[model samples]
Target: MSGSAVRSLVSALLLMVLLAAAGCAGGKKEPETLTVFAAASLTESFGTLGKAFEKSHPGVTVKFNFGGSSTLAQQIVQGAPADVFAAASPATMKQSGAPSPRIFARNRLEIAVPKGNPAHVAALKDLANPAVKVALCAEQVPCGAAAVKALAAGGVTVKPVTQEQDVKAALSKVRLGEVDAALVYRTDVKAAAGAVEGIEFPEADKAINDYPIAAVPKTAHLVLAREFIDLVLSDQGRRVLTDAGFTAV
Candidate 1:
C-alpha cells in the first residue's frame, strides 16, 4: 500500500479504538451498596433475601444489621446509615420519617419449649404455673406485646423468670433450657429449624405481630433500597416469607 494510504488507515483504526475505550470507561460507575436494618425475627428470611438481592444485582452489595426492631429504629434516628428498615412491628416503623411503610408479613406468638417438652408446658395456662419458669420478652418489644395479649386472652397471670430484649434471646433461653418455656413468634420458632419445639395455643390468633418495611430518608443507595423493598413485597418474597411460616400481610 502507498505510505499516505497506510497512514490514513492507521489513524482510522486508532480513532475507532479510542471511541471503544471511551465507551468501556463511561463515567466510572460507582459501586451500588445497600444497608438494611431488619428485626431480629427476620434474621433468617432477610439473610436469604440479602444473598438473593446481591446475586441478582451485580456490582451491588447488600448489608444487613438484624436486631431488635426498637433498637434498629433508634439507630436510624441516631443517624445510622441504613438504606432500608424492616420492623417486626408498626410501632418501630413509626420512628422512621423517611416514607410510609407497608406491611410485608405477619407472625403469631407461640410457646417454645425445649425438645421433649421438658417443661411439660402442654397449654397456655400451664405457663402460669410457678414451676414452669417461663421466659418472656420485655414489654418494649413486639413479641412481648403479643405475649401479654395472649396471656390476657387466656386469663393467665404469671411472672416470667426472665424478660428478654428480643425474640431470639427469648428463644435462646428455651433452646438452652435456661427457661422452661418462652413466648416467641411462630415464624421465629420456625426459623430456629428445630432448635426448639413450638406449641400453638388458641389465643395466639389474638396476638399476631405484623412486620413493616420501608426505605430510609438519607439512604445513599435509594434506588437499590427501593428495589429491595419492592422485591420483598413481590410474589417471590411473599412465597419465601410464607415458607418461613409468616402470614401474608
Candidate 2:
C-alpha cells in the first residue's frame, strides 16, 4: 500500500475505535431511581429525608408519591410500581398487604386553624358551634379515623361542612380559610409553620396514628428500598421525624 494510504487507513481505524467506545458509553444504563409512596402527612419530613438519602447515596434518585395513606396503600396494592411504602396507619398497611412493616413514628391529631385562629376556636367542643365551619378528613383515611376517635373520646359531635380525602386536604381547608378549623396531624400543622396554628386537645391522646414503613415485596429495587427504610429508622431519621413533630417509636 502507498505510505499516504497507510496513514489514512490508520486514522480511519482510530476513528472507528473511538466511535465504538462512545457508543458503548452511551448504551450504559443510568443509576436506578427508587420510588416511595408515603402518607400525605409525611410530605415535608419525607421530602427532607428523600433529599438526605440522595445526598448520602450519590448516584441514586429518590422519588416520592405523597397522598392519603389509604389512597397510597391502595395504589401500591393495585400495582403502582412503588419500591417503598410508608403508611400513617398500620391498618392501611395491612390492607395493602405490605409485609412486616416497622412502626417508625407516631403522630396525634390537633385542631388546625388559620394563623390567627380568627374563629376563636379553642377545644374540640368548639368545633360543634353552629357558626363554625369545620373540615374533617374523609372516613376512609387514617387521619379521619383518628379524628373520629378523638371526637368520641371528648364527647364532641361536630358536623363538618366538608370532608376531605386526606389530612393535607383538611389542612388546606383551614389554610385557605375555607373552614374555621380542621383536625390534622401535629406534624402537618408544624409543616405548615406560620400558615396555620395547631391547638392541642386532651382527647387527642385517645387516638394516635402510628407511621409504618416497609419495602414493597418483589420490587426490583428491594435493596434500595430497605436502605431507605433503614435511613428512616436510624437516629438521624428519628431526629428528622422529631423535628417534624412526630414521636419516635
Candidate 3:
C-alpha cells in the first residue's frame, strides 16, 4: 500500500479499536447506590446490616441517612430521594407515607447517666429533681414522645436542661458529661455503654417504641429497596438488632 493509503488504514483501525474499547467500558455497569433513611437509634445495627448487604450484593452500595424519625419522615414527605425508611415509631413511619410499613423491632427508654452515675439518678422520678440536669429529645421525635409517656406513667414531670433533636444528641450530653442524665433508648445506652450507664425504669415498659421499616413510595430502585428490607427482616437482621439491645418483633 502507498504511504498515504497505509496511514489512512491505520487511522481507521485506531478508530475501530477506540470504539471497541468504549463499548467494553460501557458494558461494565457502575455500582448502584441504595439510599436508606433510618432513625438515629438504628445506626449501629443498620451499619452492620449494610456491610453484610453490600457483601452479598456485588456492584451495589448501601448509603444511610440516620436522624430523628420524625425528621426523616418529614424529609421523605418533602421529596428527598430515598429508597427505604426505618422509623423508630409507626406514627413517624406513617408521616412519611411509605406504603405498607412493617414493624421490625422494639425499643424502650432508659435513664442514661455518666460512667459513675454522678447524679445518683436511680429511677425515672429522679429526673424531676431540680438538682439533676437532664437532656431529652424533643417531643416531635419518637424518643421524645416515648420519654413523655414514660414520665407520665411514672407521674414525673421533668424540665430538661436541654431538649435535643435526636436520641443520639441527647445521649451525647451524658457521654460528654454535659448533662447529668438523659432519657434515651435502651439500644443507645447499650451502644454507649462505655461512656454511660443505663438505668432501666419500670415506666419504660409503658412507652416502648415499635420500629417500622418500609420502601419509600417513590423509590427509584424498587427491587434493591425490597431486597434491603428483606435483609433487615431476615434472621440475621434479628440477631444483629437483638445483639444491639433492641427487642425483636
Q: List the residue pairs that clash in candidate 1.
A: none
lDDT at position 206, candidate 1: 89
The true-structure Cα RMSD of candidate 1 reads 3.0
| Inter-residue clash pairs, candidate 2 | none
If both were scored by lDDT, which would come out higher, candidate 1 or candidate 3? Answer: 3
Q: Candidates' lDDT values, in order?
A: 0.89, 0.92, 0.95
Worst 10 residues of 1 by lDDT: 24-33
| TM accuracy, model 2 | 0.88
**Taking the tens digit of each residue's C-alpha lDDT, what string does model 1 give over 97-216?**
658899999999889999889868889999989888999999888889889989999999979999988999999998898999999998888988888899999999888888999999
Tens digit per residue, CA lDDT, model 3, 90-136: 99999999999999999999999999998898999889999999999
lDDT of 2 at 70: 87
Clashing pairs in model 3? none
Model 3 Cα shift for residue 20 (angstroms) = 7.3
